[model samples]
Target: MGKPTGFIEYLREAPTEREPGDRIRDWNEFHNPMPEERLRTQAARCMDCGIPFCHTGMLVSGMASGCPINNLIPEWNDLVYRGLWREALDRLHKTNNFPEFTGRVCPAPCEGSCVLGINNPPVTIKNIEYSIIEKGWEEGWITPKPPAHRTGKKVAIVGSGPAGLAAADQLNRAGHWVTVFERADRPGGLLMYGIPNMKLDKEKIVRRRLDLLEAEGIEFICNTEIGKDLPAEALLKDYDAVLLCTGATKPRDLPIEGRNLNGIHFAMEFLTGNTRAVLDKQPGKDYISAAGKDVVIIGGGDTGTDCVGTSIRHGCKSLVQLEIMPKPPQERAANNPWPEWPKVYKMDYGQEEAAAMFGADPRTYLTTTTKFEGDENGNVKAIHITQVEWTKNDNGQFIPQPIPGTEKVLPAQLVLLAMGFLGPEQPLLDSLGIERDSRSNIKAAHGQFTTSIPGVFAAGDCRRGQSLIVWAINEGRGAARECDRYLMGSTDLP
Candidate 1:
């Protein structure tokens, strides 16, 4: 430990963000960088606890409790505290192939399990991680280091999202020829489209990494769907190994009345279109505009929050986010103890922007949509909703019960369904003849990452369902290790 009593002397501090009122005017990253000295002080807050649960990377109460990739947190924190910026970056890259992505978007489960968080605030781990990697880039410490030796093995990775990219980076470093296939016009499948430009700049952040990967000899084939553009059988025959990292992209739909109405869109459709328009520097005719319209977003999570932010930026007349579940407590509940992810209420970047514009949080908890009301043009005009209470069903499972006399209608010219994904689209899996679990995720063991078919592997959301980007990287690295072992009969990837 660099500073044995550092945690006792210093309090935790986080990076400042751009003011909500100012940041919503345009699409740009809201977080302001912390000074190097302050970041060092923050790093010093990492306690010398014998058991650093922050890097344990275990599941507690069915939720991620720590860094899924098992980042060497203490080592990096110590290095950063001692002003070893370059060394810190080296330690960070040892485990995480893409710290920039995770540092920006990951929920920071490691902080949740921080020993310092048991009583006081947690260390600003996420921000420090962001700073370390950005420092690496600025210092010219990060550049393409192509493999010294070639394995002469060709690998095909389907989907260029976080998982696929991580796997490609690992296999390429292992001296294998890796080719990543993406159906989108560009690479970075989810990072390029699913997230807004403000949170993660596609051209600046994502494309920069993609370009670096290419410089390292990995090939990216865009606008190419394997099952459609090219037969799935070709991958198995042409490549020495095939890894499936296609994400769980099938959005859960609300099948209520008037679902066929125009202006009612899936969250991804709205997000993906908006991102494409932003990149193209012009909104297409099909762009779902919230301008001058009362927007109603059904469901709540990162996706729902993004809808709120995007709608506000479009100058929506009003915004209301409906969440069927009750609001979480302000603090950890009785059942949620230390090291478990605290189920507490907090404002995200989107809600902050919404509050600044609308003078409220925008989320209406414990509310369920009954039906979508449409006008003569078959365009959605309003939403019928009702309050609900959690009641035990015959199976002893808690279910939302609609409360009597709580029915209401909210005026809405635009509706976005931001409910989470169900599972991976099954067409590709079917074409490849890969088996799926009950949840429709590709059936593959966690550590082995091997599917029922030989030379075929699965990882990330396609195998584990919708999850944090960090977990996807974890699985991707694991899958790559196993794939390398399969290829060379031994593996050095860690």
Candidate 2:
């Protein structure tokens, strides 16, 4: 606490965003940097609570109440307020391996539990975090520092997503050799392809980290799928230990009528193609385009939001997002008390853009897509939707039953299915002979990274099923520690 009265003196302020009209014209990030002095003032809003729940990373009533990686929020907020930027960056790096990525896209659970948020607006934690990390990069404070000693124990991490990267970083720092294998041409799994370029600039953030990891003596083998391109037995034989971080990549499909129409696509296909085109500077003529097309996005979650943003960038003619869940309450109910208010309504970046353009939130809650209708050319032309209500069935399970007369037909030139993922595809897991849990996630107990096969372990989304980037990093780090301990009698990594 640099200033005892800082919280009172400063009101919450965040980075300004590009105007909707102006930003939608380009795929660049929409956020405008807050002035340094104003950012310092924003940082001053940290309350220095007796118990800073913002960094605790616990789930209160099944909702995340803080940073999942246990980020040291107050300490860095104080440092930033005092203009000790390098120190703030140091404090941030202690807990989080990639603040730039989290700062840009992560929904700030820490702010929801902030003590200041109970009465006043929460501190601008996300903005301060983004500023600190960007500053760290600009000042050349971040660089590769490979471990001085080599333990000669080799560890192979499958999947170059957040969890795999985190584990590799930790294991490498502990002096063990680390190699990350990625199926995609690029190293970052979802972060590289699944997430669009506007929210997270691939080169500036994702590839930048990959470069640093490479310089730190972590080897990345891109386009080398474990099961297909490279045999699982080779990994088992070449490396002392294997850590599976393969993420849940299989998209959940809407298996209703006309599902295979030409213009209908999984959300990832549209997103990944858009990103690859941007990076490669060679968007093909046949590429999926939303420009001037009436678009309907199914499933309203982070992925759906991303679809909205990307479609906006593509100059979509009209956009609508459908959700099966009921609309969340505008304000936290009595049942959702302090440190449990994140579920309350808040417009994300995409929704904000949509509202600015469409004059309303694009979401149609308590609605589900019944079927798709295709035209003579085998292109999707419309979707049949129905409103549904949740009711407890005879078995005491909440089931969605469609309303009798709420069906509607909406014209759509392009339909994006963003219904989330089922689990990791089983082909690779099957090839490795790795066991899986009931959820089809790689069968490994939490904090115990070892797979049924000796010298093989699993972590990240593949092990835990689809999850957040912060959780991926946490799992990666944990798996790295356990792998190190398994390889070398002990590990110094935290």
Worst 10 residues of 2 by lDDT: 340-349
Q: State the lDDT at 454 in candidate 2.
A: 83
Please, what are the lDDT tens digits per residue for candidate 1 over residues 1-494?
78888899998888899999999899888878999999988998888888999999999989999999999999999999999999999999999999989889999999999999999999888999999999998999999999999999999999999999999999999999999999999999889999998999899899989999999999999999999999999999999999999999999999999999998999989988898989999997657888999999998899999999899888999999999999999999999999999889999999999999989899999999999999999999999999999999999999999999999999999999999999999999998789999999999999999998999999999999999999999999999999999999999999
- TM-score of every prediction relative to native: 0.99, 0.97
Report the Cα RMSD per candidate: 0.8, 1.4
Cα displacement (angstroms), candidate 2, residue 364, comes to: 0.9
Q: Clash number for model 2? A: 0
Cα lDDT tens digits, model 2, 1-494, are 87778888877777788888788787787777888899888887787788998988887886678888999999999999899999999999988889999998888888888998887889888889999999999999999999999989998988888898889989999998888899888899888988888889898788898899899999988988888888989999998999889888888998998999888989999998888888888795436889999999998889999999999988899999999998888877778888984567778888988999989999999998889999999989999999999999999999999998999999999999999998899998888778889988888888788889987888888887777888888898889888988998887787
- Candidate that scores best on TM-score: 1
